[model samples]
Target: MFSPEGPGLRELAVQALSSVERGYDLLAPKFDHTPFRTPDAVLDAVAAALTRMGPFGNGLDLCCGTGAGTVVPARVCRDSVTGVDFSAGMLAVARRRALPAGPRVHWVRADARALPFAPVFDLVVSFGAFGHFLPRELPGLFAQVRSVLRPGGRFAFPLVAPPRPGSPAYWALLGFDAVMRVRNAVWRPPFVMYYRTFRPSDVRRELTRAGFRVELHALPEFGRRRDGSPRVRLVVARRPAR
Candidate 1:
């Protein structure tokens, strides 16, 4: 599912073997050409939803690889926008791109577990980055996001519905996670990315514990599943405006 400009299979293999930081560093240059980049459609849809809820001031994009999701906040936030990620290489690539008109853009290199910022943001958004975090890490990660947001600020992200059991997509994800588990068992520095670990119910509970008033908004652009559930839903978790 990659373009010719994307990394080759050999390059991908090398990346998979490296530490998460180094692997992303090696892959950063070609990341936009790969399926790893968040799609513009998803970004645009999120931006539209945020616009309805916002007149947000400063915004932040956590784990902003190549800054795709940063565009959403840039569209909604009137003041400044920042992107934070652990990978210097990914941040470097994100910094090189031209941003859409909205706010001034800044890029920061920091781990999501321990962000370096004041609680000044009015909105925050992330895309396709949570898979890097294990289930046990969710509480701390959500706390970190909550810590950086001003009272009344939001932490938003989209969640695609999980594949139905016995489907090809389900089997593929299961197989991928199985391979990753085996690899981590046998490999050096573990590269953490799993498909099925982030469940909506678990996430909502953790966000609640992290002090966010969570809400779900269905994104109509992706339509519904056979069961009539939203194919995609946006999680808008707001810090209580005390």
Candidate 2:
């Protein structure tokens, strides 16, 4: 359990035993209370960054769990905003939390690997959901994102810098990934979350291969590490202007 309002240990155990969609369905109501939800500070920083780069016409929130990451688009997009995810339970929670009206918020249930929309969105963003996707999925995933965007459109997300070896954060993430590996080994319909799967270099390469121009912006709000590397950075991969 993360907080008084969060799901308890027993509840979490039950969730872990279920399929990923079902697990989130079980956890959806209490998800925001947990540390797993994207923090408001990160969201605010991203919103600020987008405000400077935007006046975007439409936006999409990829894999928008509980719609916490989806709200940023509603604020900056002029036409419409959509949150798409594979989990119906997560979408249900998002629907409840989303505003009644304004720029037309819609929730579409679909896998990110094969997005249904045409060249629609001007900007797209995701948060705290990458671990769910394996490295091999990146190419198709990036391609799908590219397919959904218009010329010069963007797909952006916040990524924390990998923890240095010998650091506490590094070991902690390693331990978590190791445990998840063991859990999936014995469990059916693997949950597919690994902390170390997505490296920035590999991601950039994949994005480039998928036909996007990639750029990074340091999120200075999180400050720098001992080596002066930013703690967090925004990955902005743009579809070509042509």
Candidate 3:
């Protein structure tokens, strides 16, 4: 699941034992080489969808580890792109990573729960970072995102269908969340990544409660599951224009 340049078993063990911020700080250099980084295909897919909804201004990428999501706005947004994450190490790598030619991209070191901005962005996007937040944190987190967005602004992120019950993928995710729960129980400053906790229904309800008019856009690129459900769909939540 990791590239040759990725963190080793010993490194991963050390990271897992550390607090989330310190763990990411230690792992930042090799993060992009790991499966933990959001894939380029997903980035491109989001970029395409944003292009169709195009002509946005001043974009923000929440929890932008290594700035992978910045590209989505760079192509479509007319003003600037800002990537926010609390991990300085990750932001360092993101500051250095090359991006496709587009709007000027900047990095900000800040927490998603307390962003340092006004309602200024036309669009916001996050990728593969929700697992870090517990269900109870969604209200405050979504509110933070909402506060930084202009009216009618979009807050989008992709959600993939959870694996089928009894499937190998399902078992894998179950085991991972189980292990995470145990680790948090025994460890200090928990890593806070639980894949199963971020459900579609829960997300929709939370976003609605946070005052967004939620919409789902099918990302047909990943194809559908055997059950004929979309394998991946983009959640686009819009703040009220008024």
Candidate 4:
């Protein structure tokens, strides 16, 4: 699932052996060419959905590697837009891009678990970065998002449905997780990425605990699964307005 411009097998092997932040630093230049980057289609769908939900001001993109989803907020938010990540390398790559003519764009290097911001953002969006966090970390991560948002502001992201049980996709993810678990058990500074850790129920509950009113909006552009469930959904969790 990697293009020729992406990291090669030897480079990927070296990255896999490094810590998550360092691995991403090494992969930053070629990340967009890999399947690891959030897809443009997903970003477009979220942007359209947010356009309906907003006329927001001062947006933040949490874990915004390479700034793929930064454009979404720059379109919907009236004020400035900030993209935050722990990887300086990723932020450097993002800073090189010519942003659209809308809100002013700022790239900051910060970890999502402990963001260095006030409760100033009216909207926050994150894409394809949750798998980097473990289940226990969700409470703190969601809390961090809530802390940075203004009352009634939303923290949104797309959540794809889990692959069908016994299907090739399902087995592939399961196998990937199994491999990761084993690797972490033996490796130092564990690379914590898993496909199955974030479930809808668990996420909703965690969002609620984090003081967000959680809701889901089906993304029809991705179509429905055989079980009649939306294949892709936008998880829009808003901090309650006082």
User: Which residue runs of candidate 3 sit more than 4 Å off their true CA positions?
Assistant: none
Evaluation by lDDT, superior candidate among 3 and 4? 4
TM-scores, all models, native as reference: 0.99, 0.97, 0.98, 0.98
Per-model C-alpha lDDT, please?
0.94, 0.91, 0.92, 0.93
lDDT of 4 at 196: 96
What's the TM for model 4?
A: 0.98
The C-alpha stretches of model 1 lying farther than 4 A from their native spots are none
Q: What's the number of clashes in each of the models?
A: 0, 0, 0, 0
Q: In what order do the candidates fall by lDDT, top score first? A: 1, 4, 3, 2
Residue range 82-160, candidate 2, lDDT tens digits: 9999988889899999453558888999999989999989999999888998898999999999999999999999999
- Residue range 28-139, candidate 3, lDDT tens digits: 9999899888888888998898889878999998999888677888888988999999999999999997877778888999999999999999999999999999999999
> What is candidate 2's CA lDDT for residue 95?
90
lDDT of 4 by residue, 1-242 (tens): 89889899999989888899999999999999999888889999999999999899999999999998788898899989999999998999999977789898999999999999999999999999999999999999999999999999999999999888999999999999999999899999899899999998999999999899999999989999878999999999999999
lDDT of 3 at 50: 84
TM-score ranking of the models: 1, 4, 3, 2
Best by lDDT: 1
Q: Summing lDDT over every window of 10 consecutive residues in candidate 1, give the lowest-scoring window.
A: 95-104
